[model samples]
Target: MDRTTPRPGLRAQLLRTKPVDQIVSEAGHGTGGPASMRRSLGLWQLTALSIGASLGTGIFVVLGESVPLAGPAVVVSFVLAGFTALLSALSYAEMAGAVPVAGSSYSYVYATVGEFAGWLCGWCLLLEYGVSVAAVAVGWGQYVADVVHAVSGLTLPAWTVQPPGSGGVVNLPAALVVVGAVLLLVRGAQESAAVNAAMVVVKLVVLALFCAVAFTAFRAGNLTPFAPLGAAGATAAASRLFFSYIGFDAASTAGEEARDPRRDLPRAIVLSLVVITAIYCLVALAAVGARRWTWFDGVEVALVDILREVTGQTWVGVVFSAGALVSIASVVLTVLYGQTRILFSMARDGLAPALFGRLDRRGVPVLNTVVVGGAVAVLAALVPLGALADATSIGSLAAFALVNVSVVVLRRTRPDLPRTFRVPLFPLTPLLGAAMCVLLALNLGTGTWIAFGAWTLVGVAVHLGYGRHRSRLAVPAPVPAREPR
Candidate 1:
């Protein structure tokens, strides 16, 4: 056996693992030729990115859908989902600090699990980030309609603002917002982070206003039958509500762009989750407490309507809708940014087309941004919000579960690696994280599972046809020696 030659066999090729040091080294060397991603994000900017990506959809849009499922117990549903996210977040923080690369869990899994698994995880992330961006964009469009109506007393044509089957020929506003975010992303990462940070602040303030006003109308009687549907309902709602926390890992995707990823990535992930969970709980409590849970059904802008009803003041709702407009757009921006970076990482590793790896002078992946943003916009224009949200939850749950497993695997496989942050309780924490991910995923609709399976099959075909042969780790056969004439 030649010591230098890669072992033969499909199994060996599939399980080929990249070394952790090599992963870190490639990132440091600027894998994108002359225009590598710049490290401009500090602790707060990274935290803001996570919060900005996370705070929008659940509170502004999905709360309406989730409340009906869980009734007033929806607050509990939020907590359950947040707890699940926190567990997985701990694992993400650990691996992110240890690896600190652009691909988030995709890179971590490659270093711990194998190339094929990493490719699949990255595929799941694509489903998560890309679809979530479209979902959030649709939510943004809802608020855009509301704002236009509030300002002009004229409802935009339903066909222009709503997805197909919901009366719209095309959701133009949703598509427009996705395009706007892409333009911002093309400028530079630092500029995008700064804009996102401002929007996050606005989001927090708007949520605070909602909580204060909604509490004024709170009645203890509204809590009479908290769990109108039962435990099963709450569990199901939590499965969908998991979409709310999808962007909590946004910071981890920016590992290569963080100024101090080893320390700041861990802190940003934990801090953002804690603050986001608290805000979500408070907002959910206020929402259901102020109004009967049944009233939430079919209300796309629940918070705006709640404010309008509670104060009998249309202006109040208008103000909140404006904030939501900015908030959801911020999410579309950050999640889109995360998706582009994930593709950039995969492309650099030869798992994706090289177009995704190219960057301009300012270190922005221009073509990658346009392609991803255009796809998300088309989805937003065509797909209904409910289906997009559910699909995103399933994909996110799978990616998170893999992250937890990667943490445990890496800890055992490379004890000598320096870990700036470690998941407490060792194997127990990560194991519980994986278990919780499965629990939530099982509660999702059968339709989502079917969609995920289809997506996985497509990913497998892409990998076998393209990535397997092109991967940097795929060894070439030794050329036949030529006999001397």
Candidate 2:
């Protein structure tokens, strides 16, 4: 009964009734209603979900920070980050196709690695999806406030616009947006998906417009000192650019809800990665080409600034700002959805409070939504954006690393397990995925690394304190059957 000690024959205990077949069958039982809610999402809707979740303040705001590091080579940084993301996506696709569950990488790790590793994955995901949602919400507030000021010829008080450490009293707008996203998620999954799809389209059209206009002013001179800062710069910029790719996991989280998940889950995860990477590269190319890389210093809204320069019209700025507002909202909604689902999985497994596992009549984890929403709202309203971004990036890289390893483990351990999709080149693909994630992690600052270590330590403590004792997998093992006489 000791919390840290697993039951005798722990693996057999956990594996008793939850083999992949049993899990899939249980998932199918309510496929009538839950699957219907999930089936409302299609390829386009899936693509939109990816676009909405992936395209946000990361590209809009982080681009300026990365430009300074890599100069015009920021485009290359984006490409490198995209490549890393693609590698991870392939791994996710293979695993998701094989195991199609709601916990995303957490579920895959549990089934392949062991219960303890699965618990860690669920914990790390808390930072990736939950904290990152707040970061996105905070970014949305900034753009929304900007648009309001431009259109109405008035600005909210400076204190309202800035977060606490940024010399402001409170970030009212950021907190409000987080609250709004939570309410939307608590209502129903179907409603959230529809709204997300619409917003995704709007955001993509806006980015396409920006690309078109910016190309008019594209200058060959901008390409002169690509990598002006050298390999270190490219690596550093890639680290920052990595943030833009964080939401690719959103596709995997929908595993429990996808129709024909064995097929569509992999398709959605890989397809989303391909589409988002292409869009990011195009946007980075246009933004860097349209103006001097140095000009981007101190600029927060680089895309809008590019549009303004190319079109020589103030209204284009207004239009771009509006698009940013909608895009950020979509990111918040999709990420919040992912966060709630992860907690629901953890709760169902008894690794957390059981309340999180309860689904309302609408098939939504309402309590989980409220808890996650409140935590993110407070964080968004209080923390510095830089700290939030770094924390999210580190957590995501860790999760990606585990997922890549899980794909390899599952392939070796359960070769007969049916997989609808497989990563090309076997071990090579997963190896590269882990390598890229490590390279990106190396780019994180010493402080960020320290913070990541601290977070992991905290997770260890929480597991021992609560999760170890309550884990459904830790129940006493059954006695082995005696041989027939």
Candidate 3:
């Protein structure tokens, strides 16, 4: 096969041969077998998984940084970010219903746009999901340390608990969390989902308690300097909170496991967004109202601090810290699941090493999970939380832009396909989604852009050197036709 000839009508080959149903069944079951792992997830479990992935350290920890920038208007920023996410979710719901695959945006982009764009989207998502797991693990370690000190009156050495830039030797607790989640994933999806659901409940209960206590001490005067830095500040804060909205797409990634993906995927995506955004708004309101926004500077445990101030109760801080720990663990587990499945899709399509696509005796991608977990653990142990968060945001924003564009492209090219859910405004909604993602990307600082660009260059290099040569669609140049399930 010639490597530079654009794969001889590869787009048509993929479009005609790989239908939505075929892709969903392949991901849900196995390629060369009858029944693989049990399909235990229904719509409710699926929705909970999305919520578990979306509501995490981003909400509990990042608010401290955003509040100082937007004041009480951080509430407004939440709304703006939620609106942007809602738009993208609508587009995703449509495509997920239309395609029903494991790779989420990558699969959607491939079926709609082309092979190269799909590879790029998948590569960007690797950074988004893998880096996020590491960042959340770091946050989990801080919360766990705080909980231990509050209950036992004994503290671990700072050198062992903090990341390098934070003046620590290594982040032991963070690395442990990543390792633990990796082990859980190797067991199978059903077991992992059960654990994730329990963690989600714990996190929600803690946040609800914190909100109740903080609202009691709410002071109207704290909101006086709302939008202190004006629209620019609001935009910047929205960009930051945008990170909080990253996991809503997890609902779409589980298309294969969804009971009725064409119908359920869209519902789960929108429902998760609504539920998470509502919780975030209330949390933001309580945090700002509990104390002056100016006092949030240098604060890591924003909710715990608010609870401590509101009730003058040290126990409340301990409880909130416990919740934060559980929340971060759940985030790591679910994001790692999304990442491994994406690599599985890439491997199956011959875009990556076959090892990543192989399922173990438990019908789980054990090797891919271990590889991703080990990489993230190294990052968590060595990198600063701030740097990790910035890189995650950049990659997530790029992926979001690609997904939004993919939605528009698919609608134009495949109008006759049965769509379980559709974006109401057609081109308008998708265009807005793309524009919002670009605006958020612009709000990121120069350092973040440089990091993002460097990572993208690496992805480009991998594609040119290896992916282009191994892609199945490019190898034999199969004729385009929708494959039967």
List where candidate 1 sits over 4 angstroms from the true fold: 1-7, 28-32, 477-485
Question: TM-scores for all candidates?
Answer: 0.97, 0.93, 0.93
The CA lDDT of each predicted structure is 0.92, 0.80, 0.83
Q: Worst ten-residue run, lDDT, model 1? A: 1-10
Per-residue CA lDDT of model 2 for 65-95, tens digit only, reads 7899999888889889899989999999898
lDDT of each residue in 396-467, candidate 3, tens digit only: 888888888988887777789888888998889989999999998899989999988998899988877887
Model 2 lDDT at residue 44: 58
RMSD of 1: 2.2
lDDT of 1 by residue, 300-419 (tens): 889999899989999999999998999999999999999999998998889999888888877788999999999999999998899999999999999999999999899889999999
